[model samples]
Each structure stands twice: as structure tokens, then as C-alpha cells.
Target: MMGQPPYSRTTIDELLRLIERAGLFERQPMVERKIMHYSSLQTILLVGEGNFSFSSALATAFESAENIVASSIDSEDKVLRVYNTARSSIENLESRKALVLYEVDATRLHEIEELSTRIFDRVVFNLPHAGYFPGGECSKEAIKKNSELLSMFLESATKLLSLDGEIHVTNKVGPPYKKWNLEGAAENYGLYLKESVSFQKADYPGYMNKRGSGAKINRTFRLGECETYMFSAV
Candidate 1:
């Protein structure tokens, strides 16, 4: 099903304030509550979650024991070589009662039988790169490939999001990444930006950066400068 129109809107400052309140950042800006509260009924999905690298975020989210699902395009074999954890990482996620699926394409999420019937309140993707190494050149082809990947993911994710639900993607802010025009891509799917906030690596205790596709490859992310973007159906 297509997503409903977007409603809520937020500025960068307001977004940062909200994320800070959620205890998602390394240092709390000005917390007025113990934690941003949510019901156990909320559902979350993480696409392109390699090796459970952002496992800490998973842990925090798992605290609610809500309907949490994590998908990665890479197979278990690839995860082992790239993430160096074997199946243990994913096993850990499953142990926490998370729905872990491999060979699951973010763009094809609606095709899964177990997931097709479900709707999530929050969906997240980090450094949504097709397959680029750090300090790499940004060719026109590379940019196009990245955009296409994002376009596909947004198109599919929106269909699985509940009304008022949001899709959050965290990404670096330069070179090839900036050219992706994530906001514009979401807009193409009738989604609008609701918030944008700074992201800190140390904020999530169990988080790890992308390990690329091979053991020899380097990480594809920048810790402090990245920003978290939330888009809602519109």
C-alpha cells in the first residue's frame, strides 16, 4: 500500500532537541526527562544493518522488546568476512527476539512474507551507500547508483510504514553522500523531511561503523559529522 501524506515538520534545532531528549546522542544537550518514552507496541526496522555493526542501537531499541526487524543485503558468509563476527552477531540479535533476515534487499522488503503483513513505526538505514569505499572518487555513475539505491529503498519502505510512522536514514555529509539528495528522493515517494539531527558515534554504545564488503576494505562513515534524517509520508 502507498503511504499517506506527511504531516509533522521540524527544523534542525528542534530535531536536535528531540534527539537529545531521546538520549540518542553522545552528550545530552538539555534533558528534561529520564528518557523519551514510547510504547512496546512500536515497531522498528533497520535495513542494511551489516554485522549488527549498529548493534548498540539495536540493544537500546530491543529494550522495549517491540517488533524489531533487521535486514541486510549481504549473506551470512559475506557478513563473516567483512564484519569478522560470523553468524554470532546475527544470532545475538535473534537471541534478543529480533527478526533477523539475511539476503534481504532493502528495496524489496515488501516481498517478504513475514514482513509484508507488518507495518513499522520507525525504519532506519545508516550511510546508505550502494558500495563505495572511503576516500573514494565520486563519479557520475557512482552518484547515480547511490541515488537509485536510495530511491528504491524509499519507495519500498514507505509502503511498509504505518500512518505517522517515520523512516530515518543516517548518512555522512560530503562528497558522494551529499549529492544523493536524500530529502529530494524521499519527496519523490511523497515523503517529507520531519527532522534532521547530528549523529555521534559514541552515543550508541554497541554501534560499529560499516566494514565494507570485504575484510580489506575500510569503513564508509564519518562519526561526528553525519546527520540523522527522518522522513514521513506525504
Candidate 2:
């Protein structure tokens, strides 16, 4: 039987208010514009979504049924322990008819038989961190792991992307995050960097950053200079 239509987790008007409050509505119009684009009925894949906060926003912002595929590497148990979000929260997405898959590694996406033939209009990965560390610091090992993960993800995801489609990856703006070289990593996978805009919490009103992995803070206390990098197949 066909599942019920999914409900949005948030609204554009609400998000706009948050962006305006953060004083980013003008300076970061790029990401805001992208968020607006999601309101259309487009096929979307939200990868590396921990606790599915951003994914939930996408569902709320989107206007399609079973069009948003939200995936995370961790299993339900891990999501519960690390994110403190009940299994029902994640299960509710599926009940809403959004395809919510736990334990789906973005890098190893080809392994998922169901997703093998899918072509998404928008593929998104937010704050692609290996996990939280001392004060949200990513060590050299964490840096390398993230680098490899991003590279593999770009390579795999590009193959499943539709033409005229775009891939979006957001990350911490500085330090270990910048070292991953998001644009460079995409280029290595035959993808071209399109545009990048600074990320603001206000831009996504109902969205929350769940660091997961035993992290103390849900939102990492950092310099608060995150950026959303967009890319497309070259």
C-alpha cells in the first residue's frame, strides 16, 4: 500500500524570520535562496543527517510525497543514545511516508539496492563531521576520515544524481573543517563547485544541530562560521 503524504517539519516564513534575526538574510541570500527552492516538489536526498534535524526541515519545506530520502550512518540505537531523539521520531518520518533509512553510509551508497536506480534532484549533507571532539575539534585522524568520506560520497552520489541537479554539502567554516577542502574534494569526483554561502541557524528555524556520538552539546560551541557548499557534475 502507498504510504500517507509526509508533513513538513517547518515553514519557510518561520525560517525566514530566523534568518532575519541572525542578521544573515541579506549577507547570505544564496543559501536562503536555495532553501526557497526546496519548497518546490523536487526529489531530495539528505545524507549524513544525524538525528535528521535538517532532513526534517527539508520535508517540511518540500512539497512532494516520498521525495525526500533521509539517511544516516548510525543505527536506531546509536541515534537514540547519541542524539537523545526517540526511535519514534525517526520512525514517524517513515510513517509520514518519507524514506528514512538509518545506517545508510553516504560514502557506500552503491551498496543500497533500492537507491541504486534513483536519481535525486537535490542531494544535501549538513555539517559533515566525523563526530564531535574536545570542544568540537576534529583531529588529524578525524580530518582524514572526513576527507575520505566526503570524497567517496561525492563519487557515489554523483552517479545517482539527475542532470541539471545539484549536490550540497555544509560544514564548519574553519579549522579542521576547512582542511577537508570541500570544493577540491568535489572536483576530485568530477564535480564542480557551484556556490557557497555562510550557514546561519536562523536560516533554518526548526532545525537543530545534533552533534551525536556522545557529544555534550547539541550545537557545537564554535566560531559559528559555517558554510553551505554547492556542487554539480562537471
Candidate 3:
């Protein structure tokens, strides 16, 4: 999930625009729609959904799929708007299956276990709003804390997944860095970094400008390379 600070309005807006342009907004929705159309699955869980914008888009795209559950944890009032919009869209579905929505902390596995009674075939953490917020520190302590929080996120997510299920994650690779080091933390939690999809400069929208240039650049790029990672259970 994207764990940036939630207070950077410019950064958040730009990231959402970039996400829309990159087709990520539709990618998972289409996958869920197709899977439900041709296969059989009872439930799906979306964790750390932030504003639930992506969840709303997925609901619209997969309206025909039954028993789909989407959720998020945003104490902010804006999250309610997102929930209402998605809930309204789901009312048009031909099937009468319910889409559960809740406001709960993701780091607490006991809360999740209490909220959701079933294992999910698909679990998603698009991006979280923790590390990159306005008050968040980029110091050594903050990075270490962020890493630990990310590890906890994985641990809780694993508990919600089916044995053969997959977890799809996306994150910006460090600038000027070519490889991501997932050896220590990921291995400690029985999770593996699967593969990364690289996008060229043209593939990302409004990311050409350097940082602090008044342009929004959430995904960092150096030497003309930018990417996001996908992880799964070992």
C-alpha cells in the first residue's frame, strides 16, 4: 500500500491523477470483474483503502459480481463521501449481494478478524496514508518506524488471505536505486516480493518534474526509471 502522509493535498491529488493515468484504477477492477464473471469466489477484502476512491471504481466496474466486500479506515469525513458514492453505485447491481464497509484500524489484526468472518481470495492495499503526511518525519527513525508498520500490515494481511491467495501491493522504488531489498523483513513474515512492473516516463503523468518544483511527484524516478512492486505469500 502507499503509506505517504495524508496531509499533502497536492501530493495526494497528483498521485490519484497519476494512478488514473497509469490505468491502475481500472486494472484490478477489471481483474475482479473477469474473475467473478468466469470463476467462483465468495468474498474479497480491500485494506488500507484510504478515501475508497479505488473501491468505488472497482464496485462500478464489477457491479455484476456478487458477494464483493470493500472497506477502508479513514476517521476523516471525506471517507464517508467515498463510501456513500460507492454504496450508491452498488445498488444497481443485478445480484443482491451486500458489500460491507467499515472504519477500522488495519494494523490491529484482532479488529480485522472481528470485522470480517471469512478469508478472501483477493486482498489489496493500494496505498496507505501514514509515512508521507505533512507531519511525518523522513528521518532515520521515521523510516524505521514505517518499515515496521509495513511489516505489521503484511502480517495482518496474511491472516486474512486464503492459503493459495495472493496479495497485490504497489509502492514507489527509491530514486537512483535499481533494486529493492526485501530480504530481511519480508522473509521474517513469510511474504515474498514477487515482481515489479516498470513504467517509462511517458507511462506516468506529470512525473517528469523534479521534487520541490511545485509539481506533484509521488512516485520517485531517477535515471529515467520508475516502478511499483507486487508481493505475494511464499
Q: Can you write out model 2's per-residue Cα lDDT over 54-144, one digit (the tens) per residue? A: 6666555542336778888888667776665535446556665788888888887767876887888888888776664554456777777
> Comparing candidate 2 with candidate 3, which one achieves the higher lDDT?
2
Provide the overall lDDT of each model, using Cα atoms, as 2-decimal numbers. 0.74, 0.73, 0.51
Candidate 1 structure lDDT: 0.74
What's the candidate order when arranged by decreasing TM-score? 1, 2, 3
Cα deviation of 125 in candidate 1 (Å)? Answer: 0.5
TM-score of 3: 0.58
Order the candidate numbers by lDDT, best to worst. Answer: 1, 2, 3
lDDT of 3 by residue, 1-234 (tens): 989676699888899889989757654432334422112243556666543444444454555445456565654354444333433433432234545455666666445655455676666654332444353345555565556656676777777777766665544556212222333455677877776676344432221222211123222334344444556675
Indicate the worst ten consecutive residues by lDDT in candidate 2.
Answer: 28-37
Clashes of 3: 6
C-alpha RMSD of candidate 1: 13.8
Candidate 1: residue pairs that collide: 5-233, 5-234, 6-233, 6-234, 56-206
